[model samples]
Target: MKKIVAFSLLVYCISCSPGPEKNKDKKAERKKEIQRIAVKKDSLQRDTIEFVSYNDDFDYSQLNGKKGKEEISYINDQNNDRSFLRGDLIAIEYKNDSIYIAGDGETPQNAEWIVSAKKIKDGKVSKFRKEYNLPIKYHYSKEGEISSTYLDHLYKLAEYYIANSKKDLIKISLKNKEQLGYSVEKQKKNEKDYYVLGIYVEFEHRVSPFQWLYIDPETDTIYEYDLPNDKLIEFP
Candidate 1:
C-alpha cells in the first residue's frame, strides 16, 4: 500500500510541473506581440507628413520683373510660403497636405492668408536656406498670422479629405459673412443620403483660416446638411 501511494503522488507532481512551462511560453509570446505592435505604430506615424509638390502655370505678367526672378514663385512661405500674392486666382496647382475651405463667393477666394491648426513637421517641410534672396518677405498684415504658402497645404488637405471622405454632408463657413457655413452635398436619385464637404472661412471673421468635417452615410452617396442655425447659408 505504501509503494502504491508514493507512485500516485509522483504522477501528480509530474503533471503540475508542466504548468509553469506553459506560463513561461505565454509570457514570451506576449512580449513578441507587443514588440511587433510597437514597430507597426511607429512606421504608421511617419507616413502622415511626407513631402509633396504644387505646380501652377500662368502668365505672371503683372507681378513679374519686380523680383527679377522666375516670373513665377516656387518658394512656399507659411507666412507667405507660396510664389503668388494674396489675390491671385489659383487655376491649378499641386502640393502636399493642402486643404480647401468654404468661400463667400463663387469665384475662387482671394485669400492672402491661410488658416492653419496643425503643427509643421520637421522633416517634411522644405528647407529654405538663408542665402537665397528670394521674393519672400516676413511681414504682419491686418488678418495677422497668415501664410502665403499656407493655402498650398489647405488645398492638399481638401483633396485628401475629398478622396478619403465617405460621408455625404459637408458644412462650410465663410468668415467675411456672418450668414453661415456652406455645404458640399451630392444627392443621388435612389439614395436617401448625399455626400457633402463642409469648410470654415475664418477663425472669428478676421482671418481666412478654416477647418471642417464630413459624415459617412448609411448606404447613401449624398445627403442634405443639417446645419446649425448659427452657421447655415445657401450657396449658388
Candidate 2:
C-alpha cells in the first residue's frame, strides 16, 4: 500500500508540471505583448510629428513679382555673395535676436539666412517673424496658391519613393531644373477633386514623366497615382 500511494503521487506531480508546449506558448504570448507595446509607441510618435525633405529648386523670383510688396531678400551669413529670397510659404520662428527657419523636415538645422528689418518693409517683416515653438509642421497653401517650398517637398518625396521602389534597377540621376521639376494640376478621383503634383525626371538629356503624387490641399495627404489601375494608393 505504501508503494502504490507513492507511485500515484509521483504521477500526479508529473502531470501537473508545465510541459514544453506550455512554455513555448507562454514565450509567444510575451513576444506578442512586447511587439504590441512597441507599435503603440511608434504610432504615438508619428501622430505628433512628420518629417519632410527641403526643396532646393524653389524659385524665390516668383515672390519678386508681387505687386504692392517689397521683394524680400536675405544675405547668406557664410557667403555674402549668395542671396536667398524668402518664399511665401516658408515658416520662420524667432528666438531672442536669432531666427530659426523650418525646411520641410521636423527640426530646423540648415536654414541660416539673415534678413534685416531695413531690408524688408516693416509690415512685410511682421508676417514672416511670427514666433513659433519647435517641431513646426508645414501648412500647405490652397491648390492655386501652392508655394515653391511645398513643391520642393513633393519633389523630394517622389524621388525617395522611386529610389526605394526600384531598388533592382540602376539608379537614375536627376538634375534639379525648371523643366524637370513638379507641376500641379487638378484631377477628379472618387468623385472628388484633388491637386496632383506630377514628378518629371531628366534622363539621357530628355525629360520624362516619372510619377504622379496626388495630394489633398486641405489635409495635405499624399497618394501615389496608379495609372494602369486608375487608382490612387496611399504612399509610405
Candidate 3:
C-alpha cells in the first residue's frame, strides 16, 4: 500500500516550490540559467488517501537493500553535455496481475502493444514485460471535474529533483490551458483499470548519468554497473 508523506516535509515543499534545483553538475555561471517550472494549481489538491494492495511478492521491502538506493545511469546521446555517469533513481515502482504479464510469449517493452502473445520455439524468448509508461487512474466527478485522482506522484516529485530536468526547461502553454504532461490512453496489453502515459521527459545535467528519463523504468535509474541496452535484472 502507498504510505503518506511525512507531514512536516510536505508542508515545507508545498509552500516554497521552484525553491532549489538539485544539480551538483552546474557551475556558478549557470545557477540562474535553467528554466523554473511553477507548480500547477490542481497538483496541490488533497483528498481521501487510498492505498493500493501491496502483496508479499510486491512489497516495498523488496526495495530495502543497498541496491534500493544504488545508482542507475544512462547516456543521453542527444544531449551529451549533461549526462549522468552514475544516474540517480527517478522512481521505483511495480504492479501485479498486470496485462504486461498477462500472457506468455515473446514481448519486449516496445512490443507490449501487441494484442496477443505469440508462441515461441524452445530456446527462444517468451513474453517480455517492462514498465508501462506513466500509468494513470484518474477519477472524475459527476459534473466532469477531476475528482480524487491518483496523481503521478513519482513524476510530480521529479519537479523537486535535485537534478536539472529538461521538462522544467521546456515551454508549455499552461497559461493557454494546455496539459504539460503526456497523453494517456487505455492499455493495449490486457485491458485494465489504468491508462498508460506516453510522454517521456529527457533530463540533462553534468551528473554521472547525463541523460535521464522519466518513462521507461529500465532506463529511469541507471546503476553504476548496468550498461545501456543490457538486460536489466529485477530483485526478488
Candidate 3 TM-score to native: 0.19
Q: Best candidate, TM-score-wise?
A: 2
lDDT by residue (tens digit), candidate 3, 181-209: 34333322223222333333333411122
What would the TM-score be for candidate 2 when compared with the true structure?
A: 0.33
lDDT of 1 by residue, 1-236 (tens): 99999999999899878687798999899778655543331111111122233333331111211122223332233432344322223332213222223452222212222222122332211221112212221122334333546433333334334323344321221112233222343334334333344543324444331333333334222222345632322210
Q: For candidate 2, what is the lDDT?
A: 0.44
- Model 3 stretches with alpha carbons more than 4 Å out: 1-149, 152-179, 189-195, 198-236
Off by over 4 Å in 2: 1-145, 148-170, 174-180
Per-residue lDDT for 181 in model 3? 38
Clash count, predicted structure 1: 44
Candidate 3 Cα lDDT to native: 0.26
Which of candidates 1 and 3 reaches a greater lDDT? 1
- With a 3 Å backbone cut-off (N, CA, C), the pairs that clash in candidate 2 are none
Candidate whose lDDT is highest: 2
The C-alpha local distance difference test score for the whole of candidate 1 amounts to 0.33
